[model samples]
Target: MNWIFLILGGLFEIGFTTCLGKAKEATGSTTYMWYGGFILCLFASMALLIKATQTLPLGTAYAVWTGIGAVGTVLIGILFFKEPADFWRVFFIFTLIASIVGLKAVSSH
Candidate 1:
């Protein structure tokens, strides 16, 4: 389904972002490997997004994709990159989740 594709695309967006962060921390050949992961994830994410947009409304799909990417990247940051997970940060993430769900529920397509 297109929704599944869209979700996978969003997850790959997270993958690319995580790879970028990891690449920043890497050195020498390891940095190139992370960059390679970034390139692969970027390609997959864009491909799936293009496929999903064939049926899904562009606005909703884009929003949901970015929403997933944002929330996921933030969580990844908190868990792996030692980023802050303060109250407001978490509250906004929940809000973003609700918005993504609301978009899915309200979408007629």
Candidate 2:
């Protein structure tokens, strides 16, 4: 289903973004692997997003995809990369989630 593709695309977007962050910290040959993986995942996710948008409205698909990706990436950054996880950061993330959900609900009609 189109939603499935959108979900997958969002997941891959998170994957690529996380990998890019890792690549920035990497050194030597392993850096290339991370960069390459990031690029591959980015392109793959974009293709799937395009496919999903064909069936779903562009606005809905983009909002959902970006919302999921943003949340997932921040979580990954905090958990895996030891990024700052202050109260303000968490609060903003929750706000973003709420807005995204609201938008999706309102637009679905």
Candidate 3:
């Protein structure tokens, strides 16, 4: 359950980040809508992270949460924002993912 919440929190973090970028690009009333979505996702992500930390180690939870968000954000940037997908960047992303998996494997529920 805590793991589920953690994953959801991470995904929501991605949502807020994407929405934040959209908000910056939007004009007039539409900007407010994007901002609103960003705010909503931000709160949701934080709430779930808090819930997860109740059961998981704080340090591990935080590291994994940020890892997921960082990986997702970078992937989104490459796919949607046309950011460069150089070899070193790709290699590092996979390394981060492997580290996340290692943390999960060693953690107790």
Candidate 4:
């Protein structure tokens, strides 16, 4: 359903972000591939996000899509890219999740 699109959009957003990070670290042809993948995934994610907003409320769709994408990407960065895992990062991510849940509740009304 629409929720599926939202989730897929979020996943694709994460994919593009991760690819962007990889592209920054890559060189030569591999760099171009990563850059291309990042751009393609970002466009696809935005299109799917728009589709999701048609059924879901705007606030709900946007919050869920962006929140999940951000949190998921940060997690990936920490795990795969070896990004720092400090308390402040965890706190902000939790805050984002809370805001997403709050937005969903408000949008349901």
Task: Give the best candidate by TM-score.
Answer: 1
RMSD of 4: 1.6
- Clashing pairs for model 1 are none
lDDT of 4 by residue, 8-105 (tens): 99999999999999999999999999999999999999999999998888877988999989999999999999989999999999999899778776
Per-candidate TM vs. native? 0.99, 0.90, 0.97, 0.89
lDDT by residue for model 3 (10-36), tens: 999999999998888899999999999
| Model 2 lDDT tens row, 1-109 | 8888988999999999988999999999989999999999999999999999987889889999999899999999999999999999999999989987887678653
Order of quality (TM-score): 1, 3, 2, 4
Judged by whole-model lDDT over C-alpha atoms, candidate 3 comes out at: 0.96
- Name the regions of candidate 1 deviating beyond 4 angstroms: none
Candidate 1's residue-wise lDDT over 49-79, tens digit each? 9999999999999999999999999999999
Cα lDDT listed for each candidate: 0.98, 0.92, 0.96, 0.92
Candidate 4: count the clashes.
0
In candidate 4, the residue pairs with backbone N, CA or C atoms under 3 Å apart (3 or more residues apart, or in different chains) clash, namely none
Q: Please tell me which model should have the higher TM-score, number 1 or number 2.
A: 1
- As a whole number from 0 to 100, the lDDT of residue 24 in candidate 3 is 83
TM-score head-to-head 3 vs 4, winner: 3
